[model samples]
Target: MNTLLLRPDPGHEKFGLGPFFRVEPLGLEYIGAALLAAGYPVTVADLRFRPGATAWVRRTTPRIVGISCLHALEYDRIIATAAEVRRAAPNAFIIVGGHAAASYPAPLEHDLIDAICLDDGEEVLPALAKAIKKGLPLTEVPALRLKTDHGWVTTQPLPERTSLDLIRLPARHLVERHRSGYHCLLFKPVWLVETARGCPHRCSFCSVWQFYGRTCRERSLAAVVEDFATAGDSIFVADDLFWYDPERSMELAAALKKRGVFKRWILVQTRTDLITKRAEVMAAWRPLAKDFDIFLGLEAASDSGLEGITKDSEVTDSVEAVRLARELRYGINGNFLVDHNWGEAEFQELWDFVARHGLQRAGFTVLTPLPGTEFYEGIKARIPDQPWSNFDMHHLLWEPKLGAQRFFELYAETWKRSILNTSGEKSLLDWVRQVKPSQWPYIIRVLWQTQRMMKPDAYMTEHALSRAPLPEPAARQPGAIVRDEGGQP
Candidate 1:
């Protein structure tokens, strides 16, 4: 049977760091590897290219179509893509799965979709395809919410978490044609390497831990070393927690060194406390790359703010992490969550922290209530109907305590403190010096698009567009101006 896997272009990539990075769909590639090993012909199409879902369906003529939904903001787009696939390949068995779809299958439980994979696709995809190929009931497949004539029904659960070693190396050959397009910042033709899966930390604003049941799984050290040695010079490690196990991490680093693997750049995401406690493990891995960068979740500037979000780590850990990484000659890229409830003092505190630590490279995001988390469940009913795109963490989902206009002004001001602000410390010339002449055009375009985050008007305009008008009162004076207590018409 011929199967097609798709990675849809996030429908709303106009804002945030969307313009800065575009990595390959490592998840679909892994699934494709599994299917191919099962004797199924597989085609992985990245929908970001021209000739979209409908076109790909006609060309591939696939018996099974898998669509990826990685973010909550892409929910609407995924549904629309499913409809297109349904029209193009009416007989195709359509399934949607990824971090988003599996975590909260409710958004994807539509007639257009045949099932939603509630677990790792590497195991689920092969089994689902086998069931269909053998003319067996899909109910026999584990870890799925299968669609039936009656309604969507849950299938038997997987006996255990899907092992990461199922596929030694992803079917990267499927996406090789688009390799040059995959990048992070100045690193073109980047390779995405996943050494591990899942996160154990529970941050209220994040859905990663909840989706994976707070479990961290690692691939075999040999598989990881092979992947690192064979991958491109610039790699982005897609692990939710990069150094979760200090011993395993040290072993992996030593294994890679033994294999004589080195890279131009490697980026990994980990927690602040991890860096503080496992400084030796970090030091051991430093020799693997010429320029290694760590993306730390410095979610807040104070202990109280961190505690409020159940971050479990204090502000001092963040300080020490930055100090240690810099001392070890590792590039640091950190992010902080900005709450809508924050007042002027809160913003000032964050700004002070950033300045004091010389962390202008740190990015900021609005504390969004992402779907499939406790945060979203608590506030979903209160929020008026809005596009899932607004949940990009750049748009406001509700009226803020400081009001929309003022809130956006502070938000935009916050972004201006970062190094992306070309009008501030770094100029166009400074950015140009960092890249080759051929890359200048691309870098300039990215910098130009990033400027939108520093403008209050841009955010406010999008915010106003997403908001619905309030219903008028049943009775009112003829010339009366109806306004909330905060004032203004």
Candidate 2:
């Protein structure tokens, strides 16, 4: 093999125990396309589905091995894979990239990983491959950190952003064996596509905008339509914020309609502000992607919590977004944020909101301070051990008003009671009744996964919080302590 690419797994699988987990790693696929365009033989080992990845690396014996460490949760896997690859193929040059590596490359500076990519791998990986083939020094490669005798040295200044047309469509055909594994809620064979890159929002818990150079860039509308046409009947436009610019969204929709292309099930994620504020844009997208579904960033219902997370919308905006989805008969997946700070009442309130709104799909996760985000920097010192496996958002990073076990019960029991009658039943029937007969196998697999998740032990073992450290006491100021209103000093 000339070159082999892999997407590291997230240590453990917690499928329906919490939020959705495995989606295609578009970053590696994009880089794979670039490598192919640059005239290099390449293969993608998407370990999310392909088992025995280390054995495969040993068998292939490629000259260059590229691993994508996209999420902080997958950092543990990155370390394990890098070490195994080094053992399996001692001569292979291992290069690691993706959001986690870009954010915190120091942790991966071990015995294996030859270099860490600090920018978009689309152009950088291809450049490195060329340099390797010609026996040129990688010391001067831009947006790269080569492991030297002293330490990792930064080569060149990282570029801000790359043109979206850098490589048209990811090398998705490479991972076609696992095609049946991807889906959005009830829909099977959901093709994940990116119409644009970067996010404009500054939500404190997220780091996507910062990693993408803190700017919103669009793929030319023509490019967007061309790519959309190829993603079969179901599509998931994986934009960080889809309608960040309403005009561009409308233009893209008009272009798609002109080409006489309409996907049966279209899924996209955007903020509630877009739905409530720009109703016309939602209306326009209806024709281009009928049977449209939305993943709304309705992070928190309380204004204080929303402000804490820097989520730009209000409770009212989320309400309006839900009302509009219900009226339009569009499927809804309203994601809400929760943390250990909450007592039982807060979870109960969120549960009530889902029931009242008739949301067909919903997701809730404990707020984790992932690396690369401001939240992580603020709380890093208090966290005793930075176990990458515990960063899945299912585990709490800090101690709570309620103890960890109580918090888990509150989160699990509340969701169990609220979802089964509401979104759970509705989504199950929708898939069984409407999906193509050929897709029954995939649908049945998904339902089985969901059913297993409903059992009590799944989240307990899968998302067990024993690994999470308790929150440190508040730091005392210079001034002496004083008695409070309740006489507590």
Candidate 3:
């Protein structure tokens, strides 16, 4: 049986951005490779890179078509693409998987999608492929949900692969040609590598641990180094949580050094607690930084805000990490989530924290209740709209304790104020002029993007006016439930 894997373009145009492309759909590539290895004809098409995606799907008419929905932001595009696929291949089985599908099963139950794969698609896809090839009933396939006679029926859960080493390094050859499109720190061609999967931390707002399990899993050092060698100079380890295991991190660093993979800059994401406790470990792993920068998620500015988000690190640890990164001369990108529970005063405190830490390159996102996360479960009833696209980090989906419009307005203002305040004492344009010649284009683009974002017209036009009232959620009495140190339920 012929199977075609489709990953739809993110439709950046709809989001008011130019056409942006992904290096390759690593998740889809893995599932494709597994199917191919099992002696089935498999073709992978990443519509993000390829133009005329629907036409291409029509041309490559296969018995089954699968699309990966990694981000909630791409929900509209994914569903639309699936509808096109169904039209193109009427008899074809349409399957949707990845983060979005696993998180929000109800969304995928529309007429466009025939089956939804929950959790990891690695083992699930192979079983699905075999079932399709043999004309076996799909209802028997584990880790899959099918539109049945009654309603959506889910099979037994697919076992999560504990041994990362057993899984082949995702089809690197299939992605190698498009490597330049996927860059680290944006704009630069960088290879994306995942040395690990899942997170050990139990942050309430995150769905990663829930999807990939709480225990961290590691890819073999040799396999990682091999992939790194193919990745050329720069590498971005896209692990949900790096540095969860100090020994594994050190071993990987040593392997990179030994294999001469340290030539290009390395970018990684980790928690503040890990960085604070393992400062020496970070120092020891410095060889990995010969070309390495770090990104740490500082969810909120105050401990109360942090506690609300259930981030393991305190505000102090965030400050220390920034200071250490500055001392080490590592490129640091700190990510902060503007909590819905925060009012204007809390927002100012966040900005003050960033200014105080001297963190220049920072990412600020409005807290979104992504499906499958504890955050979503806690606030689903209070969500005014179920529009998946609005769940993108940029938009506010739920009715915040504060007014939603005010929350968004404050968020946009805070970002502008932070950027202008932090990028030297000069004005926005003045800061752009001061940027190095090589970095001029990027800086200008960022400035333009920020200006566009800050414009009152853009904010008012994109977001809904007059906040939609959500169903009143059951109130939680004070001290009704006690949370652990991590604030996880």
Candidate 4:
């Protein structure tokens, strides 16, 4: 093979991006397709499903080995996996790419990884592969970082992909083992398709705009239709904010419906305000390419909290959006921000909002200052001893305003209220509907992850003692305590 691409596992003991959700490495596959198009033979191995992945890499003697570290949490695993790759094949050119690589390359500038592709690997990966194949000088590849004896050197930033219409479909055939294993929770074997890349909005907590330089380049409707048809039924439109142009989304829906591909359910992420303002879009969604579930970026319940992160929508927009989704019989995954600065009242307020919406899923995230974002440089060193894993959003890196244990307790209680109560009926129904023996593993894994979060200590990746002290249990309200599954309420 000319090049071998691998997606490293994010080393979360209880949960993972792959095994937990069964998501395929869409970006890596896209790069693989572009490389193959350039006459370079490509092989992809998603290490999550490949148990003997190290041995697999050991055997492959490809000229170039490319690995992806898409999330910051995968930093340790990326380094370890790259080190293993080096040990297995010292002669191969090792290139690390993805969002994490571009955001934080200083820590990854080690002896194992030879080069790091800074951004959009579609153009850079193929170019690098072609250069390696022809033994050409590597100076021309855009958005590239090289490790030198003294320090790291970088090339001019690559222009954001202007023509998303030209990129080929991701080579799904490359990782066939991941096909059945890829899914979103109980939604078995879910496929991923993208309508657009990059976001126009400048959310402070997010680095999407910074990574793509505030660009919102979208694929043509025909290209999107083709991609949807390629992915078949049950797709996740992996766009950061799919609500950019309401007319475009409606046009795509019309195309999907006109093609008579109605059985497929798509999951998309978008702002709540879009759903509320564009009622016609939601109306079109019912028959033509209707969304199965929408990841609504309702990042906060309070307008003040929303403003803190530069979110444009008000609290009422989220409420109205959720109401519309419920009326239309669609699931809403309401995402909210959970900060260390929150007290008991704030957690309660968030829980009340979720409960009021009758939302089945509630996603929470700590106010992380992700690298390449406007807030990163300010708070990167605030938590001196925190490992990169803490940045995954489950762990609290800073001292909590309500103290450590109280904050974690509130977190667990609020999560249980959302998970156990908000969607218990649907969960039970899903459990009853599943007939495949293969489905149990996924369901059980999901259950275990959910149950683990009930305990405050489950969030502890490192020493909890390093932060604020846990308050006495006697001081907390009886209702705030997490209930045992088999125990009384």
Q: Against the true structure, whose lDDT is highest?
A: 1
> How do these models rank on TM-score, best leading?
1, 4, 2, 3
Put down candidate 4 lDDT per residue, 316-423, tens digits, no spaces: 898898888778877787777777666666787788877777764876666666767767766655545456676776776666667767877887776776553325
lDDT of 2 by residue, 312-373 (tens): 66888888888886677777877777775676767777777777776536767677777888
Clashes of each: 0, 1, 2, 2
Candidate 1 Cα outliers beyond 4 Å, as residue runs? 467-489
As a whole number from 0 to 100, the lDDT of residue 55 in candidate 1 is: 92
List candidate 4 stretches off by more than 4 Å.
13-19, 159-162, 289-291, 420-438, 460-489
Residue-wise C-alpha lDDT for candidate 3, range 1-489, written one tens digit per residue: 778888787663332223222345778777766776777777777676755456766777788888888877777778889877877778888999988788677777888788998867777888888887788888889888888878889898866553767677777666565665664334356667788888877777678887776877888889888888776576667788888899887887777778776545777888888887877778766766455677788877767667766676688898787777666667777787765555567777777887787765677776676777876776666765556666666665545556666766787666665443324454656765654577567656555555554544565555664246444422431211222346442
Q: lDDT rank, highest first?
A: 1, 2, 4, 3
Q: After superposition, how far is residue 235 of candidate 3 from its true place, in Å?
A: 1.7
Candidate 1 C-alpha RMSD relative to the actual structure = 5.7
Q: Stretches of candidate 2 above 4 Å error?
A: 15-22, 418-448, 451-469, 473-489
Q: Could you tell which candidate, 1 or 3, scores higher by TM-score?
A: 1
Candidate-wise lDDT, in order: 0.88, 0.73, 0.70, 0.73
Clashing residue pairs for model 1 = none
Mark the 10 consecutive residues where model 1 has the least summed lDDT: 473-482
Question: Which pairs of residues collide in candidate 3?
Answer: 265-291, 266-291
True-structure Cα RMSD, model 3: 4.2
Off by over 4 Å in 3: 12-23, 160-162, 398-405, 418-447, 465-489
* RMSD list, candidates in order: 5.7, 4.4, 4.2, 6.2
| Alpha carbon deviation, residue 114, candidate 4 (Å) | 0.9
